[model samples]
Target: MSINLEGFVRRKTKLKLGGKEWIFNELSLADFARLRAKMAKERKVNLAERRKQLIEEAKGIGDIDPLKLLEHLDKPVTDEEMDAEMESIEGVGYMAYLSLKYAYPEVTEEDALKMLSIDKIEVVVGAMMGGLSGDKKKPKAKAKPV
Candidate 1:
């Protein structure tokens, strides 16, 4: 058998947000799937009807499972739409919740939502994406033999 060492373990890092330190875990496949599922559910997009439309347009496209194609159909999303989704309760809010809960197991999703306000969300999410919160201070040189 073969084993790929890459991403063998979940990455954990400390991120400062809202003037507090938080441990952020790399989003595992399961976590990503959960995030996407929640967003899809809360966004209330009519995927089923859209899927039906696609299947109709794809009539006689050979021996394929038309019903299965429904799984892949979704409205062509716009950047604006995506940005809106990211700010919604089920969007980045949910992601922040998920990321936070991994660190403080007791934190409820409600608590996570309360933690991020409109003003702080951008900073927290930006840090979560990779920034370290503050700039590094340069070290001073030491005296030779004082």
Candidate 2:
């Protein structure tokens, strides 16, 4: 029997953070490849090593005059504005980076945080794997005439 592998399609969903909403697309194959590469680059010996690296990274993040990292993640927080609140919005940035990636638009950190849910990572992973596996139902075969 010939294999049919044509049901996979990318999906998009609406995500609301704080008071704002944005469209988040399911991870494409290309996006998964990129994520894999990024993870490889960021891998550490252990959780402790990863934490130490993140702490050092945060110090460099603080030295910047503007919150460029947030901007890179398509977040709207500016250095001047963030300075007033002095809040660390890295979690929100990470969510956006993973979910939206290059298509992420400017969103406030507060709004982004509001959109984040505990199950978001699981949902994204599910979506990614679902896309890979083609979860849609296949058509039933017809019986030949007796």
Candidate 3:
């Protein structure tokens, strides 16, 4: 029997082949690997164009070390650590990070957070918000009828 994996709880308890109850906390290495590989395959099935765009954005960053960035993101990094790591990368900003993330898919929330911390990302967001503010528009005065 198959259970809906997307739900909070798994429905099926027994594996037909092993004739044993399948427990989340007690999954074997092979079973876990199989599940992970299935998820990864699903994620990449139709993302070629998006992946290309992310690669282009990374290329524009010049020397930010994509592999290391991916590694850093895969493992959790502290906010302070992120600040120190990105401090010296020229033109690396919040907007650029967002663009990069938009183009490429992240496997975890930590990776998503790392993309948000880019300097260009902040500048781009600020500009976008600034343009939407209505504070600069003045109210028109009403004329009295004679």
Which candidate number has the best lDDT? 1
Q: Of the candidates shown, which would achieve the greatest TM-score relative to the real structure?
A: 1
| Cα TM-score per model | 0.49, 0.36, 0.23
Cα deviation in Å at residue 25, candidate 2? 0.4
How many residue pairs in model 3 have overlapping backbones? 11
| RMSD of each predicted structure | 8.3, 15.6, 20.9
What is the clash count of model 1?
A: 0
TM-score of 1: 0.49
Candidate 2 C-alpha lDDT tens digits along 14-123: 55544566565665566545544443344322444645555667677786533343334333344454333312344334444555543465655454455666555444
lDDT of each structure?
A: 0.65, 0.48, 0.38
Model 1 segments more than 4 A misplaced: 1-20, 43-83, 132-146
> Residue pairs in steric clash, candidate 1?
none
Window of ten residues with lowest summed lDDT in model 3: 9-18
Candidate with better lDDT, 2 vs 3 = 2
